[model samples]
Target: MTTSTAAPPPPPAARAATPPEPPSAGRRRQRKGSMRRREAITGLLFVSPWILGFLVFTLGAMVYSLVISFSRYQLATDTARPAGLANYEALITDPKIAIALGNTLYYAVLAVPLEIALALGLALLLNSVRRGAGFFRTVFYLPKMTPTVATASVFLLLLNGSTGAINRGLAAIGIDGPDWLLDPAWVKPSIVLMTVWGVAGTMVIFLAALQNVPKELHEAASIDGAGAWRRFWHVTLPLISPAVLFNVLVLTIAAFQIFDQAFLLFHRTTGTGSSDASLFYAIYLFEQAFRQFNFGFAAAMAWLLFVIILVISIIQMRVGNRFVYYEGGDR
Candidate 1:
């Protein structure tokens, strides 16, 4: 038995080899890489249209404007001659340009803050209402949906000198209203009034922003014995500040352009074709290039305005970081 066991102890020399790992995981890695490559290619294809459009259309126009700004350009003929800084020099000394700038500044100063305050107040009031909230919101937003032409026309009829509703209403109240749209002294105010009419959109923005503000924060303020105004100053105002800045920037630009309203309103008011009175920058630029055939000067004015708006926007953007309270941003 011992001899047989000793013979059996000479064990098998062949050992089982490790089975080769399935190729599935290596195949999976290759497939994953292929998928990632496909996705990247698809993303690039998606953005191609925008990239092409900007290069061919938008950037082209912007660059063309810059080139023409330094030259005397003729809109009627496709001819342009280099004029260096002559057009810019003219704008600097032009009395009409100075007046237009002043008027624009005055309009912005009067309208921007008033529009914001009014819109914010309206939003707050709308927010406070429990019933018929949707109705009030619709009513507020209706004027914004109206066409600019239609709104301007309505304002013209309502603010006209003699037969206007405002003066008639004033007469009924035993007080005479001054010729609102006609008087140069009152023209800006009239524009301001019309400007306010279109503030419903901005109010809606503020309303939405206010609604997003934390109820818990407001609750805390209330628990801390804060009054309405105090809570608004402490919590609500800070929360909606970014919206305020956005509206201010947009309205400021719109105020500077001041075209459609000024065009329709000025023609109706002065009947004088902007005659240096209601000549805003845009109106003046239009008169120069289209009406007066001073394409060069118009280009110069356009460039100047572009620069002014750029500078102002940059300044506002820089300063906004100081005051604008963005939720979840690095404070």
Candidate 2:
């Protein structure tokens, strides 16, 4: 007993310490090198089509067009002579170009704001209707679903100067309906009016956004003694601002690229000699590229349009932070 109690066995020395157990298969992991490689391959494979299409069809063409813009280009002509930014110079100085730009700006300013307001109003109205909502939504959305070509014929007939329904109605009311498609002053306005019909999709978008807003916010505002107008002004508007901005961006681009309406309307109502009045941007671009055989100049115009769009988008994105409200916005 005394010998046993003399001392505990000496503690293991550092040299005699046991080694740590190796991890089991579950606990152990591969080096991650192969896993990373596999993930990268998968990502590339997933995006391969986009990359391939962009490279082959889009990228090269875009770059080549930009290059050609500095020169004079025609599909039939093999030689491209550099004009040293003369195309840009002409864009700024040319009177026809100036008129086109004015018309383009006018259309965009009128159409974008009008369309957005109409869409928002429609959304608000539709959102308030609980019964027969599906039917109303379908009715509202039918315009957008109709193909532009299909709508064009009806529009042409309605917009006809003498025999059209619009003129007949106006005449019945003792107001003469002006020649919408024929008169240069009225042609652009007719385009605006007709195109507003297809704005149903934007209304639907705003409606969806409005519906997604939580009822609690409205209730809380009411509890806080906010009037209906006050709640809408503070809560509803800010929340749906992102959607409005979206509509504005899309509608503006579409307005700028308005070709079909202008072209069809022009071909039907006014055969092309020169129309500085009905000079929407896309129609002007088409006329320049094909009719005038100034593809390079048209490409330059296209690039300019792209820049305008980019700048506008950047402006919208910058401005949205002020008015747009997200659920977790304050933090």
Candidate 3:
């Protein structure tokens, strides 16, 4: 009773009134959500044409072919009749399939390494040139721009048995040149030579890779008393190994699917070439589909080729990952 009663304290709700939300934060959240939605829509719209084309043309054709591979598709009647594993079984039993596959493997093994080496050499040469590099690059890349049909025609003339320019040049050097197109032993090599002509594309790829290599690394290596060869082997090659791996894979696949040049050079009415040496898998597949009307078998062959390419590519990537160096520290 010594003093008057203290003023009553404020209520808890009045003392702890909730703070209003920051107006800018709520607006920012809304803006971000709207922006994301807009970006997603725009991305879809940009890719719509490609998606439609792929679904209608590529994916649809692939599915139809897969179905046909299980049936005996008759182009004459425009019909497909189920035959189960017969087409697949024929792949195992067919001798021509084995032969064609062997030839393809041989060509891939021979051509891929040669093309890589030639492309790398050309790239190094172009990189070393201080003058007229652009002109030389254009001249070199001209072969890649030349149409396949035209290249085949040119090679057909150049690889002729007796009077070709290649043989004449060989004769001038006191070396006997083999008949490139006509002889069984030389048929694949002839194709390999033709394949090398268009390695301008591969060269350009390597050139870009070489240009990307940090000059500082080269200088550092040089400062460490590294010679040219040592610098290339240790520093330059590791940096460009990815490009090498890429070109090797692409060239190998192309070699496996070797078709146009072989067909143009050696195709006959019988669908057999000089001793079947030039009867590549693609040629055989084309013959099965078009000439023999074995659509089912051809489709099966196409699938088989695709599987082989897929498996080989996977193997290359697995092996390449071990050696290929990326600047981003990713395999």
What are the per-model C-alpha RMSD values against the true structure?
Answer: 8.2, 6.3, 5.0
lDDT digits (tens) for residues 4-112 of candidate 1: 4435576678998988978998899999999999999999899999989999898887788777878888878878999998888998799889888988888888999
Ranking by TM-score: 3, 1, 2
* Candidate 2 C-alpha error for residue 73, in Å: 1.3
Candidate 1, poorest ten consecutive residues by summed lDDT:
268-277
lDDT of 3 by residue, 81-121 (tens): 99999999999999999999999999999999999999999
With a 3 Å backbone cut-off (N, CA, C), the pairs that clash in candidate 3 are: none
For 1-331, candidate 2 gives per-residue lDDT tens digits of 3555566888877686776767763344554666888999999999999999999899988898899899998767767899879898879987877787788889888888999989899999999999999999899999888888778878889999989999999999899999887788888888888889898988989999999888999999999999999999998988887787788878878877888877776754556423777877787788888888888899899888889888877897788667776678761
Q: How well does candidate 3 match the true structure in TM-score terms?
A: 0.91
Distance from true position, residue 86, model 2, in Å?
A: 2.1
- In model 2, the Cα lDDT at residue 214 comes to 83
TM-score of 1: 0.86
Error of 3 at 266 (Å): 1.3
Best by TM-score: 3
TM-score of each: 0.86, 0.85, 0.91
